[model samples]
Target: MIDRVWTTNEKFKKRSEQNIVARSSLPWNHSCGSKSFAATMSTKAEIPHFVDFFKESHWSKKKDDWLDHKCMEKHVELENLRTMCSQPDAIPMSQEEMSISVLGKKSGYLRGYGVGRKPSNTNTTSRENDGEMIILREELSSLKELNETQQNQLVRQQQQLEAQNEQIAIQQRTLEKFQAALLRCRLLSSDQCGDDSLEGC
Candidate 1:
């Protein structure tokens, strides 16, 4: 059974290799490459049209050189990509390392977006003003409470003064009544002494 399985695996590998070669030799692949070159040349030829549309002298030898330089750079990038794909294990990166690298890139982006800058003086001053406003509000609330208490005390004192004044008025009325009674008693005694002197005569 193991020998049969091994033969089957070899057959599958050979079939895959044949398929790859057949695909590479197809006329369509060559045609596609030729089409791509034609498209690139056409695009290059259209540069002058773009310059005319924009009303600019954008088509120059220097610009063409720059474009060629960009193409060479792109070719180098593609070659590097091919090399890396051919030997993926040559510089194997673990999942942890990939995550760390991604996190580092994200942190760098955030810093560039202004996360790394110190707070401005205006922000500091605004914070200080906020704190001062809170303190002032608390002081005002306390002052309101103290004023309420003082008002209540003044009302009580006013009530007490009114009560004392009423009591003094009542006492004055009682003293006047006592003085009138004493004067009437003295007048009655004098009349009785005059009657006794006439009887002795």
Candidate 2:
């Protein structure tokens, strides 16, 4: 789900950079070149929007330094988006759709450097931060479900123990009754309570 709050640079200052390479990975998969990548997403999301997230300018980076390399080229904006951003004072973009493990360190280095490089924040955004938060949030939800399961198991075990204890109490009472009958029979003499009279005793 896309969020307007995330569309703002407030949530992703670094992502809002001018030079991004993976802009084509935007959920609104516009570029035909990214068809294979778009295939990995929902078909409904592939309907291209009027604007792309990172403005692409064709450029090159130094070898090894190719990661996170920046271009001096001026950033071009979508005429409509530029108008909206100017009036609202915010960049209009979709929420990042990628997920990363939130429990670990963030990784935002390029191979992601800019040519026409708009800092891209898409499903392809650095998984360490925004995506990681999503993954971690899901993990938190799962943990809560597991906790509920454990609690239910404990309750069932308690019930079983209670049932067992009740049965034990009944057995104890039966044993005491049998012992009392034998004791009463012992108090009788041989003539007072012979073998046949023992039944009546």
Candidate 3:
């Protein structure tokens, strides 16, 4: 849904950029009715059909959703009818069933087959379904890309952690060597104090 909105917004922006509404209107030039010079049109006014197009899209979706809901209701009704007819207490339907009967050809066909068909434009539903499929595929691709990016980030962090660990080990070994050297120097100094200590005693 967000992708659809963003794409629609981008198309609106492009239409505005192309200045499709006005063939020869210059952007910087504007004229007021001789009273106010401050009433210049903003760039938004350049796209004349933007609002209408958006509204039409909204209405189209609403209408389609309504039809879809009605169709689904019919399907549910048919299913219920079928289930009720299957019960032993229910009367058996004739070969030429009533219009409301689940086994009736007309009801079944309309409830099931009519879902993908549009009377005004046969290709509209097909195109819409294809577009939705494309969008889903694109979303999946984007998620995969994001996952790959995170994996790369994790690998880099691991490398950095390993490098830091190696540096810490080097620092610890140097500290151990310095402590040993200090201890050896103190022992040598103590050994050299023998003559002075005897004189004092």
Candidate 4:
């Protein structure tokens, strides 16, 4: 009788150990598996829709449209310039010569009547005009370089903004999923507490 009792006790202990192991390996609650499945399906369904919406969205198309318009305008300007340069009487001046002719010219009376001025004064004025032209050219070149740098910076900033927006959206989705999971967990625990039974779960 003692040996039989010992054997039965050992069998009970083994069965209890196996049950514990199985329970540990299983999901925390029966609804957990279903909830996960639902979450996965929800995410999968949303992803394709989100991608399609993003692809077809106005913001996505706006950049491309703006770029196309700019390119077209540039092409038209270049064509106009070429046509102008191809004319018979058109003098194709170098950029430097053009700048000097445009910026070096005096305005008002100085341009109209230069003969009345003294020779020394005329020489000084000419030197002053040349210095102003050089300064203007340098300023124009620096401004052009600054404009290019600003354009590059704008492009980089736009890219960074897009990347950050995408990241924020992903984080928002993840946070929503986590909130839903927490809510479900709380509901499950509440039900378990009220019932005080594992059978319903």
Candidate 3 wrongly placed segments (more than 4 Å): 1-128, 199-201
Q: Can you give the TM-score per candidate against the true fold?
A: 0.35, 0.32, 0.35, 0.35
How much does each candidate deviate from the true structure in C-alpha RMSD? 28.8, 18.9, 25.7, 47.0
Residue 1's lDDT in candidate 4: 80
* Clash total of candidate 2: 14
Expressed as tens digits, the lDDT of each residue in 1-201 for candidate 1 is: 856665778887688779789677632222122233324334443422111211121123444532234334433443454455357233322222222333234453221111232323543464557767567657766776887899999999999999999999999889888888988889999999999999999
- Candidate 1: the clashing residue pairs are none
Model 4 C-alpha lDDT per residue in residues 162-199, reported as the tens digit of each score: 99999999999999999999999999999878887666
- Worst 10-residue lDDT window for candidate 4 reads 49-58
Q: At residue 182, give the lDDT of candidate 3.
A: 96
Question: Among these predicted structures, which one has the highest lDDT?
Answer: 4
Q: Count the backbone clashes (under 3 Å) in each candidate.
A: 0, 14, 0, 0
Candidate 4: residue 77 lDDT (0-100): 47
Over 4 Å off, model 4: 1-131, 197-201
Question: What Cα-based lDDT does every candidate model obtain?
Answer: 0.47, 0.42, 0.47, 0.49
Minimum summed lDDT over a 10-residue window in model 2 is located at: 96-105
Q: Candidate 2 or 3, higher TM-score?
A: 3
lDDT of 1 at 127: 52
